[model samples]
Target: MKTDLNQLEPQALVDAFLKYPPAGFQVHEPDNFLAFFYTRFNLLTTLDVALHQKIKALPGYRHWQNMLHLQTCFVGTTVTEYTLLSAQLSAQQMTEFLKQHIQKTRLTIIKDLPLNSPFISEMENNYSQELIKSAEKNGFLSVEGQALAYVPIDFENREDYLSRLSKSRRKNLKRKLKSLNEIDVEILATGHAKFQDAEFTAQLYRLYLNVYHQSEIHFDLLSPAFFQAILQDGDSGGTVLFYWVGTALAGFNLCYEYRGNLVDKYIGFNYPLATDHNLYFISWFVNLEYARVRGMKFYIAGWTDPEVKAQLGAEFTFTRHLVWIRSPVLRFILTRLRSVFEADHHWHQQQELKS
Candidate 1:
C-alpha cells in the first residue's frame, strides 16, 4: 500500500521550500522522522477586522496583544497541501510528536489537516481522524479552516465547461473572458531562459507583494529567495503563466503538474491593470482549459477567495487546524471566541442555508 507520504506535495518541492521558506519561518528537525516550521506569528491576522478591533479595545489590550504574539511551530510546510507527516503514526506516536514540540512555542498549529481528499488513501483518511481525536483529547482545539477549492477537468472544451454554470454566470464569465483576446498569455516551465533575468524575476516578486499587502489578511510574506529558488529549479514540476498587455507584464500564476492534477499555487498581478482586464476571471478559465487540454484529472485551486471560487463552479474540500495554546487564560479566551477565527466555515454554512 502506498503510504500517506507518497500522496503529499512532491518531496523535492518540500526540500526546496524548507531551504528557502518565507520570511521569519525556520525549519526544525528535532528527529529524522519529522520537520517543524517555527515562526513568530501575530494571532490577530487570523481574525476579521471587527473582532480584531474589539480585541484591541479590550482592557489591557496591548498587554494581551503582546501575550498573544505567538511563538508558533507548524507541523508541516504551511503551504497549499495538507499537513504531511513523514510517516503515519499511531495515536500514541502522534501524541509523542506533539509532546516533543508543544512546549518550545507559545502555540503549536498543525494546519490543513484534510478532513476529505480524493488524493489520499482510505488508510490515511482513518489515521487522520484518529490523530484529530487524539489531539483533542490532549487539550488541542480543532478549528475549521478555509476550504480548499478544486475543479475537475472533464469538460470537452471551454464551451462545455461554461454550459454547466448558471446562465447568468455563464454570460458574465464569457464577457470577462473576452479580455483574453487582447492579452498575451505565455506558459513557461521552471528553469526557463526568462527566469535567468534578475530584473524580470524581481518584477514578479513585487507583484506578489502587491497582492499580499492589499489582502485583508497578512500572514506569510514570502521572500525573494523563495521565488528565486522555485523559478530556478527545473525539476520541481513548476509552471508559470505570464499574462502580458502590450509589452507590459500584467500578472503571472505559478502552478505545478503533479499526480495527474494541475495544482494552482501562487499568483501575482499588477492590479488596476489586472482588474481592468478582468485577469482573475480570465485566468480561471485559462487554468481550467489548460488542465483539460493536458488531460489532467483535476485543477487543484489553493485555499482563499472561496466564495468567488464557488461562484466559478469549483468544489471545495475542508480542513481543520489542531491548535495547542500553552497559556490557560489565552486558551479560555480562544475557546470563547473560536467563532471569530472560523469565518470561512461560517460563510460556507450560510451558503448551505441559503441553498
Candidate 2:
C-alpha cells in the first residue's frame, strides 16, 4: 500500500491514482481555477473533512460571509505551490486515512466544459480515459457548473433580506403576481425533475442561453449533455421542477442538501413562456418560498443574479479563500517556481490588452 508515486509518468500515475484514490495532494496557483488541479493526484478526504469543518466554523455565518458554490471541498482543495500548514501526517498515513472515512467514496474530479485546451477534446473525457481504464470505471461522472449567486428573499435574518431590496422593484413584482392571480393563473412546483437526454437538455440549455444572452453579460455556455448529467444525479437526490401557466417547461433547479443548507444550482426557464406569461418571477415563489417553508437555512441563488435577487430582499456577501497547508514542502517550491517561470509568457497578454 505504501507506494512511491514520484517514480511514475502520467500513465502510471493514472494507475496508482485509481487504485488508491487520493485523499489529498498538492495544487499550485491553479489555472482555469482548476483545469490543472492535480497534474499529480487528487486531494484526499481527511483534509477535505477538516477544511469543511473549518469553513463552517469560520466567523462567516454570524457575519453572513458564506461561500457560494465552492464551499471548501477540502478533499478537493486547490492550493498554491509549496504552501505548507499543519496536516501532521506522512503521505503514507494520510493515504490510509482517506481510504477509511470518505463518505462519498465514489469521488469525482470536476472540469469546466469548453476548457481552453486542445490536447483534451473534452477535459472530462481526457480525465476519464486515464481514470476509467483503471477502476469501477463505469464513467459515472457528474458535472455541475456554478450558477451566479442569487440574492435570496430571506437571509439569516428576515429583516436583512428586506432592507436590501429597492421599493420600486419589490412593488412591481408584488403587483405582477397579484395581477396574474386575478386572471385565474396557477403556479405549481414540479417534484424532483429530470432531463434524461441531450434534447431535453438542449431545450433547457437554449433557455439558459437566452437568459444569459438577454442580460448581455458574459457567461459560460453549458452543453445539453451537462444538464443531462445533473438531472440523472437529481433523481437520486430530491430535485425541484416547477411548472407554470399550464404547459410551460418552466425549469428544474437542482438542489443539494449540504451542511444544513440547500443550494439551488442549475435552472432553465422556458424563456418564451417566461416572456409570454411573465413566469420568470415565479421562480422567486417556487425556489425561495419553498426553501423557507422547508425550514432551510439559506436558499442559494447562484452568482450574478444579485441585482435581481436584491429585488427579493437578498443580501450579498463576498467569499474568501485561505491556504492552511501544503505537503512535501519541496513539491510546493518546485511548482511555484514553474508558475513564476511561466508567468512572463502569460503576463504579456495582459500587458498587451492594456497597451
Candidate 3:
C-alpha cells in the first residue's frame, strides 16, 4: 500500500529510499512491488556552449528545453534510479506493465540509469546489452548522459592514497593544504553540536545558490529545507562538515552513508574566500580522509566536471537513460535529435589527457 513518508518510522526511511522513496517524490504506485513517477520542470541545459546554442536555434526546441525526469531524492546527481521489490516477475512482464500503464502518462522522459548499477541485476543479466535491447523493445530512445566520478577508497591512510597520484599533483595538493593551516575543519554527524544552527543553515543555502546560478546546466534546485531536513532527520545517515576561519563559515559538504559507500552529495562555499583558500581541493582531501578512517570501500564524488576529478585520480563511470516519448511525432523528432542531448564525448576525451 502507498503511504506518506512522514508517517513511516525513521529506520524505514533508508529502506523506503532504497526500495520505494516517497519524500519529495511524486510517485505512481502500480502495485506494492512497483512504483514510477518523474520530477517535473527539470531544465535540460548543458555546459556545452556551442551545442546549447545550436539546440536552442532548432525548430520546436522549446519543448525539449524542459523535461520530466525520474525521481532522484537522496542519490545526488544520479539522474534516474528505481527499486523493484520482488524477483518473481520476469523482465518481459515488467516491461509490458510499463508500456500498458506508464507509456500512457505525460512523464515520458526516464533518465540517469547507471549502466554499472547492481540494483536491477536480475532484470538485465548483462547490464549494457540487455538494457539496450529492453529499452528498444519498449519504444524508448536510449542515450548516454553525464559520466559520474568516483574514488575507490582502497588506501590505508591519506599518504597511501596520495602516493598513487602524480608527483606534481601530489605536491600541488600538499601546497594547498599547507596554505590553509589556519582554517578549522569539523565533521558533524546528524544532530551534532553545530548541526542545528539556523543562521548557518541560511548561509549554506545562499552559498549553494551562488554555485547553482554559476553552473551552465540547471536541473534540480534543492531548497533550504531539503538541506536542513537531511541533517535533522536522524536516520537519513547525513552528515555535514564545516570549514571555519574562526567564526566565519567558509564551506560545507553534505554527505551520506549508504550500504558501505560514502557519497559526497552536496557542497556549498562562500565565494572569493573559497577560491583563495582552495577549499575545493581541501574538501576533496578531507572527504577522502574521512572515508579512509571510516573504512568505506568507495567514495562517490557526484556527477559533472570530469576534468578536475580525473586530475584528482578519480575514475569515471558512465550513465545511460531510456527516454520514452508518448507522442509519435515528438518521438521521431527526438530519435533523429539524440546527438544534441547526449554527453559531449570529445570534451571527456580531452580531459583524459590531464590524467
Candidate 4:
C-alpha cells in the first residue's frame, strides 16, 4: 500500500520543486534524489494561540522571540499532499543528511513526515518512527504535530452519512445545507479551457491569497505558479469546484481524485460573501456528496481546522516533525518546552470527548 517516491523519475523531482517551491523559499538542487528549500522559520508557528499570547505577555517576550527566529532548511515540501522522501533513504542516512545540512543553516526541519499512513508500508512507517527516535537520540527536537483529517465513504447516500453523526450535529449541518439552494455550483477539471486563460488563472491565485492571509497560522505561502501548474496538468486528476452567487465567485475548492479517494487540497473564498452564505459547511457536504456519488472509498479532507472537521464527521490520523536545532543550548531549551507544540494533539483529544 506504500507509494514509492523512487517510482518517479529523478528529473520529475527536480522539475517539481524548481517550478513550484514554497513561497519565499530559495530552492536548492543538492541532488536529483532529494528536494530541499530554505527559508526563515518562526518557532512559534505551531504553538496554540492562547498559549502564544500568554508567552507574549511575559517579560522580554520580544527578545525571546527574536532569539527564536531561525534560518532553516526543510527536507520536504509543505505544500505537497504528503511528504516525499526517496525510498532508499534510511533513518541513519536522513540523520546524517540533517546533521550536515544544519551546519549551514541555524536549523534543519523534516516537516510533516507521516508517523503512520494507510498508503505507506510498515517498513516506511517504522522508518519514520525510527528517524524521529534517532533525531531525538542525537539531541534534536522531535515534535508530534497534527492530524490530517479524513472521512471514509461507507454510506449509501448523504442522508445515511448524516444519520451517523450526533442528532444535534446532523440537524445543524442540514440547516447549513440550505445555502446550496442560493449558490450555483460548477465543477471543472484540470484540462478545462478556462484554466488556460491568464487572467482567470491570476484571479484564482488572488482568491488563494485571500484565504492564506486570513488564516490563523501562516506558513508555506504557495506560489501562483503552483496553482497554474495544477490547473493545467490534465494528468494530475485535479478537480476544482466553483461556487457562484449571481455574477460573483463566492468560493472554490481544488481537490484531486486518486486511488479511490477524493483528496481535498486547497481552497479559496471571497470573505464576507463566503461567510454570509455558510460556504464552509456547504462545501464540506458538497465534497462528501461528490465522493459518495463517485463511489470513492474515502474523502481526504486535509490538515486544517481539525475541530471544525471533527464536527463535520471527519476522523483523523496524525503526523510528526523532526526539528534539529544547531545550538545545543537551544536544543536543551526546546526539549524542556516541547509540550508547547502539542496543542493540536490536545485539541484532537477534546474532539474525541465530544464525539
Candidate 5:
C-alpha cells in the first residue's frame, strides 16, 4: 500500500504496521543491524507491537502522523520500529525526539537502540529512581552501557554449585553422551546446514514436533521461514547452532556473540532418555566449553529457571531496565499502569497454569 504521510491514521497506522511492516527491515548487508537483531530476539517484536499500539492510541502524536511505519521481517536477534517523523522538524529537534523515545517509554520499540543517545548521560547519573522502578515493574534487564558491562553472576559460592551434583548425575550424563555418541549422534551447527535442503531440515523439524505432541507446555516452534532466515544470515557471517543425535536432532541453541558473552538466547532438544538424558545439564558444559574455546567471559544465559541454573554453577546476576518519557504526566501514568499490568498478567498466568 502506498502510504501518503498526510493521510496516516494513528490506529490505522498501528494496524498497518502490525498488518504489514517493512520488508527492508530484514538483516541484509545495509540493514544487517536491524536484521541480525530481530533474528535472535523475537521479544523485540512484542515490544515493538506494544509501542506502536500505545503511541497510536496516545492523545496527540502528530509527529508520527505523517510517517509510514515499516516492518522488515528480517533474520537475526533484533527487530525495530522506525519511520521518518518529519522533514519539518530541525535536525536538533529530530535528534532529541529519537533520543527521547530511544531511552524512555519502554524503548523496546527499537532493538539495539543506539547508546550515544542522552539516556547514556542519565544512566551515568546513578539512574533515576523512576527508571529503576519502571524496570522492576516490567522485569527487563537494563543495559547501562560501560557503567555496567555485565550483570553479576548470581551464585555466592560452591554449596549451591555442589548441590547440582547428585549420587549418579555424572554417571548419568556420561552414559547419555556415551550412548548417544555410540549410536552415532550427529552434532552439527544448524547455522552451517543447508536449510534450503528441506529433507534435511524436516528431519530436525519432525524431532521438535515430537516434543510438542508429547508435552503439555506451550512452545514457540519455528516455521520454515524462521529457519531459512537463520540460514540466509549464516551466508553472511551470522549463525544459529544445533546438535543432532544421529537422524533424530537432539538440541539447538541460537545466539549472537559480541563483547565476550555467548548469551544462551534460546534452545530445543529431544532425547530418548527424556529429561534424564541430561541434555539440559549438558547445556551448561556445552556453554562453558564453548566459552572457553571462544575465549568469551560469561554465558549470558538470560533469566529463567534461575534457581536450577544457579545450581549448575551460574552466578546470580542483576541488570536494570529503564523507562523514560518525554512528559512527566505520561511517565506517571505509565508507572501506575505498569503495576496494574503486572498484577493482571500474573493473575492470568497463574490461572493458565492451574487450568
Candidate 6:
C-alpha cells in the first residue's frame, strides 16, 4: 500500500510484495526486486475474453499457462519501475546480476520488466538489448507488452489547447465542459490539513474499488492501505481533486508530480452522476489545465485505452518484456506459439485508424 517507495525501507517493500502470493507461486527476492516462481498454471500474456475462453476449452491449456514471472505488486498504472537498488546498479552489473539470479532461482520465464525512462537509461538500452539477445541465443523469447499514453502540456490555457484539437473534438469537449458548469471541484494535496481525515481516505478507497471492479482487464486490485499509505506519507507528493454535486461527492482524481511531470494515477466516481456530468472528459481537461498552470512539461495519462487517449492528443510509448523459458520442450512449444504472446497488432492498427 505504500505509495512512496523512496520513503519506505527496502525490506518493507519486499514484505508488501510477498503479502499475497498467487496460488502455486512462491516469492523470491533476487537483490532488490521480487520475482515469483510459479509451480503450476500461469498466464504468459494478456488475452481478449473470447480467445481466453477458447484457449481454456483446449486440452492441456492449464499446463500451457504455467511459467515463472517477475513480481508486479502495484500495476494500477504503468509508471516505469526498476529494482529497489537500481540506482546503484550499472548496466553490466545489472546484466550479470540478472543472469546470476535467474540461474540461482532456476526461473524459466521473466515477465513485465516495466522499465521507465530512468531505469532504461541507468541500465543502458544497448545493454538491455544485448541481455535479451543473449537470452534469445539461449532459446528465450522476448515480446512487446502494453504501450503507455502521455501528453506534453505546452499550451497557455485550456482554450489555447482546445484550438489544437480537431474541430469536432474541440466542439465536443466544450459541450462536455458546459454540462459541468455548476459542479464544485477542489484540488487537495497530501500536505493539506483536510486530506488527513480518515473518512476521506475510506471514501477514496471505496471509489477506487468501484472503478477497479468495473474495469474489463483487471490486473492488480489496490488495497485501501495503499491509498492510505500514499495519502499519509509526507514525502509521497500525492494530490486529489474532488468533484462535488452540492454536498455529495461525485468523483475524484488522484495524481502526483514526478520530476516536472504530472502523473495522473487513478480515478473513482459515483457512476450515474459521473456519466450524467461527463466527469471523465471534464477530469481530462481539468488535469491538463492543472499541469499547464503548474508549468509541468508532461502529463502521463497511464496505460490502456489507447484509442481514447489518442483522440485526446496524447502520444504513445510502448513497453516490452524479455521472457526466457528453461525447458527445451516448453521453449520449443512457446517458440511455435509466440504469436499468442506478441503485442496486439490488430489493436494497434485500430488505434492508428483513429489517429
On lDDT, the leading prediction is 1
lDDT of 6: 0.62
Tell me the TM-score of model 1.
Answer: 0.93
Model 5: per-residue Cα lDDT over 1-355, one tens digit each: 2211111112222232333333333223221121121222222222223454676687766665543322222211221111212224433443344344344223232212222222123332232333334434443333321111122233333233334566465455455544434233233443564766878666555655665455432223445444444443443223355554455556665544544455554456666643545566655655555555666555556534444553454443232223334445645655565533222234334545874
Residue by residue across 1-355, what tens digits does model 1's lDDT show?
1124524455666666677787888886554546678888887776766778887899988766776677788887755488776454676687776877578577889887778677666666776788889989889999988888899888899889889899999999989988999999999999998999999899999999988888877777888888888888898788899999999888999988888889898899997999999999888989998898888888999888888999999988888889998889989999888888887788888989998
TM-score of each: 0.93, 0.44, 0.78, 0.91, 0.45, 0.76
Off by over 4 Å in 1: 1-8, 53-64
Rank candidates by TM-score, best first.
1, 4, 3, 6, 5, 2
- Tens digits of per-residue lDDT for model 3, 1-355: 3322111123333343434433355545444434444554342453366766776788987785554343221111222222222344444654565567554554454455446553224334244445456768878777776766778888888788889999999998888887469689987887664658888678788988877777777765666665666556666677788888888888888777766777777788888888788998889888988888888877878776777887788887666666666668767876887776665455666666754
Candidates in descending lDDT order: 1, 4, 3, 6, 5, 2
After TM-score superposition, what is the CA distance of residue 26 in candidate 5 from its true location, in Å?
A: 12
C-alpha local distance difference test of each model: 0.82, 0.39, 0.63, 0.79, 0.39, 0.62
Task: Give me the displacement of residue 286 in model 5, in angstroms.
Answer: 1.5
Model 5 spans with C-alpha error above 4 angstroms: 1-193, 203-223, 235-246, 271-274, 316-355
Checking candidate 1 for backbone clashes, the offending pairs are: none
Q: Per-residue lDDT tens digits of candidate 6, residues 106-204? A: 334444444344323444444445555665555457766665677888788888888889999998888889957868889887657665888988988
lDDT score, candidate 5, position 147: 14
In Å, residue 286's CA in model 2 sits off its true spot by 1.8
What does the lDDT come to for candidate 5?
0.39
- By the TM-score metric, which is better: model 2 or model 4? 4
Q: For model 5, give the 10-residue run with minimal summed lDDT.
A: 75-84
Score residue 328 of candidate 2 by CA lDDT: 43
